[model samples]
Target: MKQDGDAAVNVPPCFISNHEGFRGSIKNLIRDFVVTEIDVGGRRVTAASANHTSPCASSDANSQSSAQFKQESDASTDCDVDATPPSFDLSVILGQSVSEELEQFVLTLKDETTAKQELSLGCFPDKHHRANVHRVVRHRFPFLMTITIQPEIRVREDPDYRELSQLVTEDEAEDFFRFIDAKVRGSSYTFGPDDSKEHRTAVHHFMSRRFGKLVETKSFSDQGTTAITVRLREQGRPKKRSGEERKEEEVYTGFTLRKENLETLEAISYMAAALGVLPSDFTYAGIKDKRAVTYQSMVVKKVSAQRLEEKAAEFQKRGMHLSQIRSVGEPLRLGRLQGNHFDIVVRDLRRHGTSDTHFSAANAHTCLEELVKEAVENVEARGFVNYYGPQRFGSSQSVQSDHVGLALLKEDMVGAVRLFFTPEEGDDPHSHAKRHFLQTDNAKESLAMMPLSKAKERLMLRALNRYGTGPDGCAQAWLSLPHSMRVFYPHAYCSRVWNEAAAHRLTTLGHRARRGDLVWRQEGQNKLEDAGETSLPQIHVVTEEEEQQGAYKLGQVLLPMPGNTVKYPENSMGTWFQERLARDGLDKCRFRVSSLKLNLPGCYRPLLACPCNFRYRLQAAEDGRGEVMGGSSRSDRQLNGQTGEGKQGSLVLVLNFDLDSSCYATICLREIMKCDL
Candidate 1:
């Protein structure tokens, strides 16, 4: 049990502030205000928005990127966007949003293509938490640029290349020669689908959407697969050459990856270990799916494209193919992508049938397509709910729960250590074994299981195994873990609270607040800017009715993140969220613990999600490619309820949508699936 003293000390010094000086609001951007696919607007991607530019090997590459940004800024146009819902009975979708006016539920719906077959559905998913460290940033002053030899793993590639190429869409695949003509300097040498006529032979089979488990399509064999074929800039070691004019070339390398089941983190870990470099040496912008066959770029310092190619066979054995090898002068950074072009295949529509039912084989294709089309159009009109993805919370993993981070924030050293060291059965044996031995006081035995792979956890365990239990030991162990990993837990807790707060606001207020309700001011169109500053005045309540300021805009609704400096909305829904925090044994005022590196000052996120460039297409699986495994598994049987109404080798629905880097694609899909909120 947590002690009283711990709670008292945990209250941040700022909690004492009356917050009476100014009744101004803390402004924030809606979390779901993502740069949609339409936002890309056929503009060439560029390095202008990159976090940092390194002195590299190429001048033309640098010049081209800068030039493209200027040229493309005006040329940028949104993709095909539906400003309003279509005339065809949008009552089902709108009713799904509010839930009251529902004369048209899924029960009444029947597939038009397959003799009016019923439609089955599935839902959204994620592994993300962008930390909000504004509380600490506030105390530091106007601006403090402390550049460390920091090694944060995330890729940032030049966008111009992905944009300039016609490969951005399925339609662009037609003109290979035109694609080559407009390609950048090194792109001609890179391995692409258009490289050989054979590459295009079975392009449909290799399409990203068809590759998922839902549809068991034989991936047409190809010399070069589309495993994130892109030229990325690598920051390399500049060795002094005894030449007349010594210079630097921006060493560009093609960072390609294709793996199933293994996540990006583990892949980077394996690659780093194999190369004898620190795991931090590998960086990429986005973390791909662990279960899905996803591809993305990665950066390795000093590792030449040639060296990576030579070891490609060895790398392949590690379960992931890397090809399309080349080098560039600019290194990829995290949070630096226009958007992901998704080709997701949703299978098992026929399983929604009342029984092992009957429908025409040819009709199966048209039926699935229309149902999928309805889902796609619905998502396009009303965006998905921007809930925090499932990955943020702990499951059966070593970092058992984010509560440990909350404990640390509360200054409950004992509680933090207990949760951190507690070993649960059926968990990661590596973490479990070490923690078990440490708690058992078998320091020597624990060391055996504690390897470099377990560095973060071992640091804490090592301290306890040697020094035994105490506040000093616990504190030291907590601090020893990498800053990034340590921050994730507390940040995750904050996200959970934020998600609840968002949900409450949307459900209660019809996605907007009434006059006199506490609402946040807009800091910017797409960012929560001010709460990060240490100093913030007491928040002002919203006097203007939401409808007065165009109730439908993304800017109108921003929910506060629980923290000390941030004030709760003076309304019933806001009180509900505060009660939720208390129920979780958390206090908004305890966010600022002076000694810790991060503190959640609390900011606002959008209450709703409104995605654009939302598109989907339903298609019949080619030949024996698409198969429904719904009846085989117990879970699938439960999901189907009634099964096999259509043909054995049934149809599949393909969903195509673009989301912002911070947004969850799963949430968007969840909205379409109409699963429980």
Candidate 2:
């Protein structure tokens, strides 16, 4: 499971050829990672792979790529010697004081008096088939005449060596770094992610968002408000057909809803329940935050304006109501709308300085505002890493859903079911109870004990009880859950793979294209086309200078989202992508289970995203109580306007911006806050 919420770990260091390299730290501050997916024509088209090519493979010759990769790795296994032998040494000493003359004569002994000894030493062999090359040393014997010599008793003070390079000459340090960098673009040690980067940022202690702060506005395709009345032009046909009055064949009731402290899925569930349809019946462009006020459009199908008007009170009772409801020809589907407009208020300003500096609480606020301005300018100029937000994974602070995805990839049905059903870090009472009892033989009794609100669990448990909760039963039970839920198992895995790959690409390659690195196509449909018939996606090969230019213009690169038909790049980043899957105990083959094919097809995400139309305003925070006063809620109708007419205090920063669909707002916030969200 992705425990990215707490981000309880640091960015693990990267290695090249088993040697340490320049390391970047991790960040975990932002909470409520929301995505405002910008609508593109369609993300359905994926990069095709060469015939029978495995994601675990690194080259184009099928296993030849993997084998070629093996050769490269095999070549890198050569170890350099830390200790080199110097020339020979000879010594003589006399024990008796009367023998001072003899000692002096012995001390003057010539090199001809010493005998030479030659020895050979060998290091551990690598690749098993290749023997270790031996080093030969020649040492001259010490010449002594009628003398007793006391060896010098010396103690060497040694400090612990933190890295391998510590044994090398200081002059070799740069060579090591350069060697790793040169081979890093393709070596697993350089780009392989041992641990994932935590993108979450911590919320400032003084800052907090007052929930139910959602404000909303709306627009419709027809530019009309409300669905109570409808008009039909009949599209060049007579108003009346076949002697009967022409009637509307379809209806799209579009309205804007801004619900405070409510999950978008739950709100849609409420609307779905009220309309006597499944939650899937209604579609939305993207999911919004559950903790704060988020405004988004909704288009319910086949519902009349009168019906919507009649249910207004019910919607309000459910902590949400529609406004600017209008009828159109089409129903809403995911990614139908443009993007979300976020009017977020981050409260309780506190100033923090870099490691070299500190800020007093009095000036902290002032310094914080200035920092945000500076960070905002930096963000506006460049772009933020388009990392997947926490929302992509479920919001349980403890155990995560990604583990289940990985389990599914490994085909561990028992493990997958256990992860899905068990009470996890963020599971509720019902979830806990269901998981606990369902594991027992009395699964039926446990089913009766579960609440109706635990519908998904209940359905799965019912299937398990009937089939007898063993492997077959669990498989049957898993099959009984919603297709979307089933698909999530793999999708979550895909998200992690993407997260790790992107992080590795950025850290190792940065923004510039390196030699052998694949760049996205600049023209045509702007989509990466298949490289050749039965080969991977078409990519551009750029010069080193172009790579540098690309880094300057972020987003010049593409980050492949992991999937069945998805082709990873052919550069060092591509090797890392394939290696990461292997490290995770997954491969492209695992993605194509006939039983779970709904989630098989994959897509591509940009390596970076700059928030467009970004802007922020700083203000003082209001007293906690005054934040949500006159807003209508499930309990009571408090205000007529969407947002209560009130001013935020002088202690908060109110930020407003329109983000591209699937772009993380938290990333932008992290760049500015320079701390946790």
Candidate 3:
């Protein structure tokens, strides 16, 4: 009953069920495992259900015009509307004679075709009058950007100058430039002289929003005043259909992402490439299993449904599909899901018996059904030990993720870097580059040999080549990976600790609420999303009185993942956590890697997890045809490579269940199968 890979991570062999488990293989076909995410609203996200039109889609022509009209009215009320000369109320702010002359000037400027046309409103003696003129020009004649020189208001009709007087601080400008560098190509912005950097930065941001990366910007001093210029980059503008425009109103687009045999990130990368956006632009509630066909909700910023629809064929060719594409108010954040519904098929089942004799298909099916029922009943009654699955520790026996994490925690950058570059067994594409680096200690050469698909490795190698393999270089190399990828090592280590601690708690204290144990202060508030990487959930330590009163059940108790800020239990479990960390050459203080900005502020997780809506079906595989249970349609089954054919003379077990967020279905399967997963 020992767990595979437990030696590396100290995960113990344990099972809550005493019912005998039969031999079976899972994920024989990609379709054998189907997962659909359950959103926060407790609605399961499925492919079939996602085909309906989204309510947030853009309205028809008439409704769009009405919306536009309403927006314009709102703008007018806010004093932000672009008013024409006829509609402008210049007389309200200026004398009639002056207003008439200003209106005439505005008309002249509007008609001028020159790249830059300027007119000076003879010095307004009063500063208040000058301010009013500036405001009037901004709201009334938005095309004519104005700058005040002393008491005189000078108006200019420069296409780039329009709406360029808004403010953006230096810090904001720097941050925007960084974003542009990271996410854009051939894009830049410039600001106009208001003698204010903030105003110029604001203008730059506006230009960026309007033109995106299609244009670049530059600023220069003109007569002691700074002015910005935005021009098309060398790449030039993309050819667009007539009347086709970007939907500026669409900030975030929510869509159902269905992928087969691709990890969530990998699928997102493909979608992002097809849509011509960065992979980081996509956000999902959780990462789904790679080997399974999964359907989940995903959101991308500034991407329209039309754009996504345009890539439909490409996505289909890649075993992916998108549906229910619509505008959403916000992007999806990780761990926002309530849970996931699993439709898993365990094929090639063989009942465990006193003798190794093959049973008839009928007897085998009946026996397996009874066994499955008992297992399911035991699980529903006693629950299962919530251990982090083997996937969390990684598939490599040569080196686990927690090993790199442990090195990182000890601040052994060189060791961590070496571990990262360690060559794995089998035909790994990165092995040659890794071996080259290890042998020659040449990051540049190693990078040249590295495959382009190994993006994280290439990034680290580049950092190392540029900075040299010193402490700082190593740190930079590790940090060069995407935030999600970089943090996984540390998080994996935390998972290892949690798994070992949970096992120890189960073996020593049993599965019962005890004094000094920690439970979530509020039910359903245990936002230990993404394994406590984002934020800490509120928890309350169990008092002796509460323990004796049987106030908290075994499922209510939680254990803390080691971190700098988390409080440990007052019982022996807490002491065991400290002792375990000590054995691993770590302490709570070491969890904070200040230089790397990797702080582990730990969170709590329930030691036990029960499957909800649990149900199972056993079918005979004598004819190599097995039926799938749950919500899977025939089309879905076919798309996932389920051909209704499995091993002959074998029984198939189809399990349908819903697990809470952060719970691993693999662990649940292992508990039922009583075998290494």
Model number with the top lDDT: 3
On the 0 to 100 scale, the lDDT of residue 225 in model 1 is 49
User: For residues 224-297, what per-residue lDDT tens digits would candidate 1 score against the true structure?
Assistant: 54322322112222323463332323344656576655656667766765765554556566665554545566
Quick one: ranking by TM-score, best first?
3, 2, 1
| Residue 124 in model 2: lDDT | 15
lDDT value for model 3: 0.66
Error of 2 at 62 (Å): 63
Show model 2 residue runs off by greater than 4 Å: 1-255, 301-308, 326-328, 353-366, 425-428, 441-455, 462-482, 523-545, 548-552, 588-590, 624-650
How accurate locally, in lDDT, is each candidate? 0.44, 0.46, 0.66
lDDT of 2 at 553: 41
**Which residues of candidate 1, in runs, are more than 4 Å off?**
1-258, 300-313, 320-334, 350-370, 394-400, 417-435, 438-444, 450-470, 476-480, 516-542, 545-556, 563-570, 588-596, 601-603, 620-646
**What TM-score fits each model?**
0.54, 0.56, 0.64
Per-residue CA lDDT of model 2 for 1-677, tens digit only, reads 12112342221122111111111122211222222222222111111221211111122223222211111102111111112222212111111342343334434432335522211111111111111011101111112101101000111111111122233333332333333222222222111111211211111110112111111111122343221111122221223336664354345566666565567766766676677655555666667766654556666766766787788778887666566565544555654533443444454444442232322234434455456666666766666666776666766544477887788777777777777766654456776565667467566777777775455667677887899767778778777764555676677768767777776876777655565555554432233322111113345555567665654244556666777666667678778877788787775454765654455767766666665445454433224442412212221111112322143232334455555566666555555554434
Candidate topping TM-score: 3
